[model samples]
Target: MKSTRDTHRFSATTSRFLLPTFRRPCYLDIIKTNVPKSLNKSNIFHKWTEEGQAPYYTIINDALLSDNYNILNQNMIYINNLREAIKENLHQDSIKVYRNLKFCSTYVKDEYKEGMTFLWPTFSSTSRNKDVASTFGNYTFEINASTNDFTYRTDISMYSKYSYEQEVLFYPYSGFRVKKIIPDARIIQLECVDTIEVESNSRILVPEQVKIFDAERKMFVYFYKDNEDLHWSHADTPDQMYLIGQNMNGYWDSHYRYHHSNGYFVHKGNNLWEEYQNEQFHASFQQI
Candidate 1:
């Protein structure tokens, strides 16, 4: 019989939790504590090290309509149809959630006859004003089918350059005292959210910007910027991109408040290929 320790071969990647390594002290008088070390240096471990861990966020609300829920509850027809279509297109297994992001679902759109694509509420805040909120943190997801797979790349830029004035709520501990204050601050620097390359058998059209909503003379727009390297010559199926940003304030303690933007991009169609390149696109974000 194998020993317990032997049964757990050190693997840096496949292991879901942390594995600290033992090492000799580098200095005579100094000590290092809590240094996470894992075995086998696998892809998963490397990802955690480089990007930190994926965060758990609150699911603010439900995602689907009652009719859709009834359909799924009564039978597997819709799901089965979608699975078969995607499988046929990708020549592989059925669709599976990519990175296990907070909320993800699939629906059959009229445009997609064989199968549907994945959808997620891109941002946490619903403010239509670009100056209302911002988001930070970086994560990548990959969805697999039978023979092929596609990666949904999300890179939220926490650093840009923008300043605005907004009302803030100050919380006082030990009581229900609420204070409102307006301050001129760079709620968040303007950040760029661009969708990475996708991979699949079908034509996955990149996202385009539209005037989503406007109120009180404030305009909120969703637009795509073409990958500069790819000129208009490739318009129909050109390498595309989209940019969005917002500002909001979060308060946890009476003395502290945090401000950031919520901006992101998701591919619009089926399994296309988005290269998981590690190239740095811009300067590092300054934590707020």
Candidate 2:
């Protein structure tokens, strides 16, 4: 079997801190000094005070590493909140939420040979509830972990960028299909997408040009292709490789998208952003 050494188990050493802490530091002095303009223009200073005086802090110790106060795995709080919500609705404490507990990142190959980092969601639920797999016929909940709102922290710089040609990383993808789309003039300009996946029977139709475009959205798109074959095919490996692409629509003035390839991508930016991104991307190796 073809094996991909992409998916990695997260070790404690993989991260320094979460993105929020980096963007909006938890320290009061740091926030006040660095973002003085924000404080002066808005009620941020007052909000900081409110945070300091939040009712829970008086009753619960926020700094402790106990179950009640997990400084490390902040995602646990989201999990616990979900558990409580489920318990309240179902009225069953037996419904349990569990996780691998260890932090693991999946990597993939991208335009930049260096891998990108995608933080895996460690939460899973167990219940006396009916088996969804048996009833639904083995359906899977694929978290579009590539999207920014997934709430998992991603560290893209975990690996340095390299060349795709020089690096010979093997991935366990069953194969990929190249699609040539000719969209309506009114719709967005997404003409071609190369889907590298484990299982796909989708067909590819050649376009008039080596590159296809939608005159409507005014964008340039290309999919990965092998030199010899019209399609890229590979045998399934023990460890599967998943590709992630992030569309950073509005990070910069030029209309472009930022692409991050891991098991998935971790995107940043709000809903209204548009194209042209001075892209900084890397690949990741993942198992699934």
Candidate 3:
């Protein structure tokens, strides 16, 4: 009985400091009996705490509450440090990629006032969202033989420059095909292109002389074979992704295209781009 009375007395003395919120199931139960009957249970205090103040027999000690507060603060600090470390690791990996790869550039020899320069976007595992894949993947190249020779194991494969369409060739694709480009009779010459990827069961009838015109709107992607009256099949439009060519079967009867191999091309052939590209390219940085 004495101990109960003493706890009640302790709460009564601290009544003025405690605010009302005793009605709810809270720590206020600890001092409920000590509260004066005249005090309302729903009042707010001058300050706020995790637990609202309430009158009870045993007042919650401030010292014990402070120990818990210190522990919570330390946990928050630990979480912040962990998050920062993860970001730093990501940044370091990005830097390492830049230092390793040797970067090269490409561009046109002359200036163009009005033309849409197209390029296939390369996949960057870091910069792009990992869940999404890059739709535009394959790209064609002029393959400047002297400077960009694929003879070396590390060199990139040289393809046609007019990479407007995805041409489809026949089964003998393992065999090479002969292709050439010629400038049309005009004041301004047309932009050059190349054949990158060919689909199966399609044949492009090559013409005697490659024709050139102002292909501003990304028109047909065809190749000239020889003096033959027939022209090789070609894609309808540059914007169209799929190129379908027909199988060539005619007088030559060789099945092999022209005097050349089916489609096997040496890097050092034709009026390919030779001038050094003076443009700057960021090979390492991410799109982000």
Candidate 4:
């Protein structure tokens, strides 16, 4: 994820007072009466979808897009609570959602060409009603997604203040592939996919021998061929090894983190491996 300043700015002085406003009795009463009691304990979902006056959604999303650890850390409790609420309310089947944005620049239309894959680094709010989405802007995104896919999304309509909009919330770091673009309609069609799937589709070739410095572990890791299979060994635990194999797509990947985990690392190139877990970038190993 990359850091971006909030394009829509509020007064810095008043912004500090916004969060505490949610603690008021009126806000609590509204949440308690409207949302499920179990999920409303923290009122995170209500806060997230609240409109006007209390811009919790914008504040939290701005922090996420900022990619500032300190800013994110300050809001982690609310973020985690909201995540748990969404997880509890996750949709069971595939869904279609729409989002409309007023683009100040042509960066999305220009850079995100059809068939290109990209990471949407911040939490996204969408609507099940196309007409409702269109009320926001001309550049509309029509998304096809699966609950079982590599993204965490939930039907937040039941929890939203504006329930008529039929809101659906996608957590941060959702992976998307541009399926098609209708220039005439200003519409972009997107398909949800795993981040690793996108990285593996790259044309970069894996090297026979590779050494990378793991920033998270603060150690050098080595990968080499052994008995016709590629294996990796950490410098701190050289005796322990993990195997890497080519998938049906002919991309090299390894599930070294945990058994039965959907997360893994894919060799994106000779000098780089992209690690994805929980539909997000867990880490990256760069050649040292």
| Predictions in order: lDDT | 0.19, 0.20, 0.19, 0.57
RMSD of each: 25.2, 23.1, 35.4, 13.2
- Candidate scoring better on TM-score of 2 and 3: 2
| Model 2 CA deviation exceeding 4 Å by range | 1-123, 130-212, 217-219, 225-288
Residue 192, candidate 3: Cα error in Å is 22
| Ranked candidates, highest lDDT first | 4, 2, 3, 1
Question: What TM-score does each of the candidates earn?
Answer: 0.19, 0.16, 0.14, 0.56
- Put down candidate 1 lDDT per residue, 45-136, tens digits, no spaces: 12211221331111101111111233233333322232222223322223321121121122111111222222222111111122232221
Name the candidate, 1 or 2, with the larger TM-score value: 1
Tens digits of per-residue lDDT for model 3, 185-262: 111111211212211112232224433222233233233343233232223543443322332421221112221222
Model 3 gets an lDDT of 0.19
By TM-score, the best candidate is 4
Candidate 4 residue pairs in clash (backbone atoms < 3 Å): none
Taking all chains together, the TM-score of candidate 2 against the true structure is: 0.16
Instruction: Give the range where candidate 1 is weakest over 10 consecutive residues by summed lDDT.
Output: 169-178
Q: Residue-wise lDDT of candidate 2 within 134-247, one digit each (tens)?
A: 122111111111222212121211121311111111011101111221222111111111122111211122112122222344332332222111111123331232322342
Q: How far is candidate 2 from the true structure (C-alpha RMSD, Å)?
A: 23.1
